[model samples]
Target chain A: MRKKANPFFYLFLVVFVFFVMFPFLWMLLSSIKPLSELFGDKAFTPFSSHPTFQSYVSVFVDYPFMRYLWNSAVVSTITTVYTVIVASFAAYAIARLQFKGKTFILGIVLSVSMFPQIATISPIYIFLKNIGLTNSYLGLIIPYTTFALPLSIWLLVTFYRKIPGDLEEAAKMDGATLMQTYWKVIMPLAVPGMFTTAILVFIAAWNEFLFALTINTDTNYKTVPVGIAMFQGQFTIPWGEISAATVVVTVPLVIMVLIFQRRIVSGLTSGSVKE
Target chain B: MKNSGMEGQAGVELNKQDARLPVKKAPKRERQKKESRAALYLVAPAMILIFIVAVWPVLQSFYYSLFDLRLSDPKKSEVHLKYSVDLGRYLDNYPFLISSIDSEIKKGNDAAELQDIKEKLQSLDEKLQKDPKVKSQYNAVNDKLMNFKQPSEDIRFADVEKSTAEEFSKTTESVSSQLNKAAKKTEFTQEKKLLGLASGMKDSIIKPTFIGLKHYKEDLTEPRMWRALGNTLTFTVISVAAELVLGLAIALLINKAFFGRGLIRASILIPWAIPTAVSAMMWSFLYDGQNGIVAKLFESVGIVDKMSNLLTTSTGAMFSVIFTDVWKTTPYMSLLLLAGLQTIPSSLYEAASIDGAGKWKQFTNVTLPLLKSSILVALLFRTLDAFRVFDLIYVLTGGGPANSTETISILAYKVMFSQTNFGEGSALSVIVFLCVAVISMLFIKFLGRDLLNDGNGAGR
Candidate 1:
């Protein structure tokens, strides 16, 4: 039988949980409360509001939120698709191909991962303006690919290298070109890395704010983060509308993670801090 | 498995190309050459894209810094000019001609030529106010005029860099006086200042040039640059310290098996997974002071009976940001340390227990040293990240309650973007890059080989 828990651990656990969970719970609470109850001196509770979907209703009816959601989905999905595809083929090349400058390419890709996105933001902004990519989905897609590629390529390379070359050599000896060898032999083994790269890229694409904020000026194509951030208009802070929008935006990721926690954790750990 | 030889590791030791020697076994020379070409072709997509997307923009940013182009423009006069400069660069470009002049003033060799250029420039400025093209050119010229002059040793040559920084705040200070005030500051009247001004002026006669030691020289002189460095140092120390202590506490608590352990674990990851900007925005809303939970908690805890907000005052605002950052990021630190904790192989604990070691003894002797690499990893990442934190502060406070929370990154953004001072921004970016590189180098050198090899012995 489990004995009484360490009091020290228990006390610390309570404080930790309170600190972590308080904001989320408060978000839920504040979302329901009507404007009047939210403003009052008394402490607010999740159920304090008049139990209304009025905030949710207003968010959809009032703003082009659905359009924003669509735009975000379109851009992030395109980014994920390109990152995975490009990173996979390229990763396959680096890991398997004994091509010239192979190590040089790997080191350059690795260094690119560490370069601060902020330093390059101004230059990219100017370049995009020249190419007429600014204020467009293509603008976001191109840069997002750039941002996501290094991580995608790194993760894929790690996993690809983990696979044995014997599998590909067998295919190669059996009358396969290197392209066919990669597609037929090694690609199937790299499923885990591919999925991991796709999901992480999706997350990065969804989470990107700086580019979405500055590059895109119009509301028609705003991402969820930018949309909710600039939600405040001419007069009052639309707390209700903004909160509802956040809940809607956050729900998909929360659900996706809850359903696929194993994959995401493996993806995140390997794709970032570890091999 | 002999990766040391087969795996691709380039020799950085050789600055030039490595001399390739022939290997004994080759399947077919003709086929091998074709395959090599194919391999280059295969990797070409990623290589080209990486170049276009990643390195190209930086090259573009550097090149743009050389010319003068302000985005707040509508255009034409060869599209841009090099006449505009900034204080730091002017200070950098000392013995440089013509610091701060009227928008109408243009660069010339002597005072008489300078006056003629000034008249022509003034006429251009008035026209610019009306014409979009002229206005764009005018703003470009104006920025150059206000920022060009540097302090020189000779009496006639010294053009005080007047403060145009507060000009957007001040309506009365014309571009010319701004230059004078900056030039007149005899505070930098030292030998190093004279040399820096002289060297910087000569480096670029037309555009701003680097005085090799000007940035360093200004580090001793300029208050704003020094303030930014101080801010970066302060932010790094406080944030990392708080994160470490708090993260360790949480990791220890969660290490013990408990009810709702899985739920709590997942719940903790929630904060980490939520994007930094989103979390910052969420805290900003909750920290809305007038109706914030922070105010409510303060009242509830008996700290302040009057339910006051924490963001209205400068210190309070700073605390509010720190508190939110700690709450959100401590999980990342814990996760890493927890990973390290897992690697400890509880057999050590079992052995300690058998030896009759106490819990404190086991933790101190058994766990602490074992946990070193991961702790360093966590510390390195957090410290570097904290030093350059931009998004969180940008979202929450915009570096305010009077610039109290402005870190180096935010200060760089303002100088580079908001003020359109490319030279200063470029200098700032280079400094930030160096600082990050230095930290990484220190971590690698001191933390042993963990920087390159992840603790898990996979690659080897």
Candidate 2:
């Protein structure tokens, strides 16, 4: 038997939800509104009198928006793939194998992951310069994989440890080699964990600003975040185009994150929460 | 029987390592050793990658902080061991300048002044001839200049002593300044050319720039660095505290069974899920003085007297950034706390209620104590993150309206990239790392003791 809530409770919920949703809603509405109406001192309503797709169209026509999207996509995809592969191997060894210094290695990974990116920039920049990797996709991919590995390993290790030991024992009893059991049984069970790690890694690489800003100087190689920030006009900032670009870059990520909301939440909280 | 069997097993295990009569146990041990080797192989790629990517760079950053590396100055672009002369640059300008000076003196216009300049040039050239290596390189470079060939970098550069470099630079400066004054009065054909060439020679002297810890000393004394750090600390402390309170409330609110809980949870996560850069840009518009609805709303609420004041004033910009950060991250904070909340049994709440504990009493006695570890973990992560903040504050205020909002990370970036001062930038980066390490140590040493102690006590 559910009891009726107080009126103030409903009011609080309504206000809280509205406050949470306002920025996104504002971004959407502002993206569609004509430039003239977007800045006017009108009541804060959801719609404008003259709505247009002019800003969205201009983002493509007047800028290298598509190129930035491609660069971001390629970088993020490669980063996710590399991070997942490297993290899985290390995580599997950590979770199951009776190896010496396993605890020490995990501790190192955790501490390094906490290191501020600023500390690593100058050396990485110089190192990449020495190796001729600067302004290249491989440049961004390597560091992204390096930084993402610790978290990916941590999350995957948590999941891998939760698997039943009997399952692996059964695989061994059925004439399976150690590699064969890992490939067939463990891989299948760990797929969801890998998927979650991949999504988070992709999102992280996609949104990364500092390295992307520093590593790629050529506009041809710049990622979305840097590209959008560098968008310029002769005398004025074209706010409409910027807002449209933000919407373009952000909406797909928002949709994807919402779609995979449960997996993301679980992946994020699993390591930190000590059950 | 059990004790005897265990002792027998232990005796066999102890003797197994003696390798005398334990052939049957050897295969299992061999397999275990092979597995350990395999694990090492499995972990090698990641370890090497991490070293190259993460560990190596930090070490490299520390190395770079010792030098005075500035990309804008060609001489300081790379580390130098000895004071070197760009024989190529010297040859390119020296011969032409001498010929021009000779021609102007021959023209009999400003003869005395031109002769003085020529004598200064000759003395420096004679100084150059004193060193055997410099003389040989100078001759070879002079030959190249005669041939109108681009001097090869290897053959065209030679090291000079500190005194020679200083004397040569001083002479070049006086000669150029004198020529500059003479060129105004003389209508000689090559007087202007002589002045330009002399000044170019001054730039070719590369100094040994291995200034160990000078940048660190300079930055430590610089007030701008301290101000940026203070701003970062202020933002971290205030924003994190706000997020904690709001996150705890939201966690409590959502922890209870309610209608539309899933929708509320999903909607709240949308803020956290958006890319920080995009959200920062979005907030930039909302904080825009001219047309931002959020700014207008703030004005209406009397938070500020003017709509434009939010991002344009020092206090308002800091407040706006912190508010935006709280808006974006409270959901994440709540989610972490909710995970902690889930672990608390409802029986504890029921028992508290039976003990005449009201809601606030239950919250203090039950929720707060149980949530300590979770709160600590959340605070640790958020504090480190908030401390290293760059993109949001970067995009929003741009550390601006007078750089009042610039954090240490943004300051490092501006110094390193925008100004191309890599040495000082690296020092700032090391400082940030030190600060982060200290914060992590504090959390682990103090709060982590309780978190770990409770686990051990409970497990036993």
Candidate 3:
């Protein structure tokens, strides 16, 4: 550790933390204020004189927010689960086995990560409509899983490589088949890495707006992001309910980040940095 | 102790000994083949999914771009390879029109000219029925129409010869004009319905909408496309550059040994963890003209002339979005850079200090050179991400203030979905894809070579 911190460093930290935390703080505070207080001079006040949970009630009662939350949960959960399973198999293959076109496969994964989603939206929409999959959970899950595979595979490959080859050799010597060795031995060791990938994948699927907006336009299947985006009222903007919904959606994610901060950071930078 | 050089020679000798073992080579090769087969099986599911969802759709979009497909226009809704007729529509009008003309002729109004028009229409209908395929479909559609039931799609459209389609269109047009002239001279009750049915018959002759590459030509030359591309580039360059600087500063700050470092790190990630749409909404609220706190802060700090001006003006809206982006993404950038920073050995800084180097010199000499790859990787990711921005601009300003903030993706979406011009929108989408491809190629060629090579090596 350094001997002594400078005053300027402390000042920078204070300013940086404030800049980062202000929006979240504002969102939470604004969600609790009454509609009357939110519109006029009282909006500037950091603390509302009389806080109310009316907006929270309105989010669930007046609007179909419960359905949106359920829709988002289902889509994100399935996307995360499906992406992790498929990506783990591919990642294990690339990491443990010598194969032709491994580099080409990795290149494909990298390119898919950078693909623009708008370019593919129309055809996908047409396809979903033709197959009657639009306005269904599978519609969002399919695309979300496809988009999440690249990063999940990349992260898992790094994790799989860290496991010793000797263990697999030992398992093989014990008369275990290749699939048995993978399922019984390697997968157990990859749980931490999968957890990290799951967090990232779930967050991504939860936050995906474009595909959700286009693919599932039915109100019954609108996810949280789409629901909040398309939120409206007869005459007003419904900022209060929107803010309440945002807080509801974001708090769980913030908690997840806090709990898995180290894993998340390591998973994100695994392939990018070399020592 | 044994010499290290001798250990290397012994290792090579052991490999040679292994090679001499009997029947070792064949089984080893077989095992290797089996492993390769297993690897293929493992990777096939993921590759197939990606192909179906991502690759296939892009190719389909390219194909759709070759035609003029508009949802609002009934005839142009799908790809038409050749001239065809909506038989249901034709039967709906053709029989009614023929009967109306017959009644007019019986009324003794220009009998000779009306007789010529009626015979022409009969010959055109006969010519259309000469093709067996059209004849069958016409009968099927005519039956359905007579029963007052809607004709199914398979039986409703029939392919016709180009000559037949042209004659059908011409006869209906001429007959409708002649009826119009007769209606002016004589009192006729069915004249208005007859003219409408005649014109409707003309529309039943569907033309081929496949204008190959025409949309591409128009969009590539259009000023609106150029402006959207310009806006995209401007947003990408400015926001990425700002994030690089601010992220570097934050990365350096958080990398130091300090109190509450973990807490600070987690707190900063809050912005990134929030969904982009939600964040856009949050910023819009903050930038609201009437009651927004950030807008007021900007005005009081002299960043804007007024609180409302921040989101209402072109320059101010651009500045506001860029500022919000830098706020949201800088933490992610810093996190990546910090990973790179942690890999640098502390001994290098110590050696620099021993050589009488100051902080600035150490950053320039030791840190920047080693951190080049990380910086490039971060920039490549951020640049592409910023270029393809949609939800943020879509939700915040909605590409408004006279579309000064419309990016290529937003414009493509509007063209495709809002206006239902799928062909033109598809052309725009292909353009966006081309731009992304070019950007990726440029980055890979100039800066990301080592990063990609490292990716390949990492798997090995």
Maximum-lDDT candidate: 3
- lDDT tens digits by residue: candidate 2, A163-215: 65556655654657778988999999999999998888887888898888889
Fraction of reference contacts reproduced per prediction? 0.34, 0.55, 0.64
- Which structure among the candidates has the greatest DockQ? 3
Pairs with backbone N, CA or C atoms under 3 Å apart (clashes), candidate 2: none
lDDT of each: 0.65, 0.83, 0.86
Tens-place lDDT digits, model 3, residues A76-152: 99999989999999999987887899878888888888889998988888778779999999989877865798878
- Show where candidate 1 strays beyond 4 Å: A1-15, A42-46, A96-104, A164-166, A169-177, A271-275, B1-39, B66-69, B73-221, B256-261, B299-309, B352-357, B447-460
| Over 4 Å off, model 2 | A1-11, A126-135, A170-177, A231-235, B1-29, B94-149, B152-156, B159-200, B447-460
Q: Residue by residue across A1-275, what tens digits does model 1's lDDT show?
A: 22256777677777777878788777767776676766756445446736677788888999889988888899999988987898888887777665677667776776676666666677776667678877789889988866799888877877787776555655654568777887777888889779877887888898888778767868887887787777877888888777777777766767776766666666555533443
TM-score of 1: 0.73
The window of 10 residues in a row where model 3 chain B has the poorest summed lDDT is B1-10
Deviation (Å) of B273 in candidate 1: 2.2
Best model per TM-score: 3
Deviation from native of the Cα of residue B340 in model 2, angstroms: 1.1
| Candidate 3 docking band | medium
Taking the tens digit of each residue's C-alpha lDDT, what string does model 3 give over B159-270?
8888888888888888788778877887766777877987888899999999999999999899999999999999999999999998998787777787777787787678
